[model samples]
Target: MDSVRTCVACRKRASRTELLRVVVHEGRLVADDRAVLPGRGAWVHPTARCLDRAVSRGSFPRALRVSGKPDAGPIENRLKTLMDN
Candidate 1:
């Protein structure tokens, strides 16, 4: 059977492959494209809406089990690049 995960923002379960993995590194949030990052991670749909929801709801730090707000600039820039291409 395929693995499943819940989106931190939407709180919906989905096939693991259908979601993007995010992790906190150096107190910043980054997309884990390979899903092999070494840390507590959060999964989310790879869309701006989901990303925005996660951010606006302040879910990143909680999902990632970290204190304070983690920088999501990297993820935003990556998403922008993907949209542009």
Candidate 2:
């Protein structure tokens, strides 16, 4: 079975493969569908609003438990990229 994971914004548990895992990588945050990264991770809906919520509320820093040098421009671009497809 696919591992179950939760979306921090929606508070909904979903299959790991069904949700996007956001991680901090080398002082930057990126979404990893591959689920491979060091340190902690957070999940958000694969939608723009949920992603916006996660970024706006500082959830990534809280979940990863690090002070964020948030590159939200990249994040927003990534979400837009996904939504465009």
lDDT of 1 by residue, 1-85 (tens): 8799999989999998889999998977898989999999899998899999999999998888888999999998887786688
Across residues 29-85, which tens digit of lDDT does each residue of candidate 2 receive? Answer: 788878887668888878988887877788778877888456766667888999899
Question: How well does each candidate superpose onto the true structure, as a TM-score?
Answer: 0.93, 0.87
Displacement of residue 30 (Cα, Å) in model 2 is 0.5
RMSD of each: 1.0, 1.4
Top model number, TM-score: 1
The clash count of every prediction, one per candidate, is 0, 0
lDDT of 2 at 56: 78
Q: Measured by C-alpha RMSD in angstroms, how accurate is candidate 1?
A: 1.0
Q: Which stretches of candidate 1 lie over 4 Å from their true place?
A: none
Give the Å shift of residue 59 in candidate 2. 1.1
Off by over 4 Å in 2: none
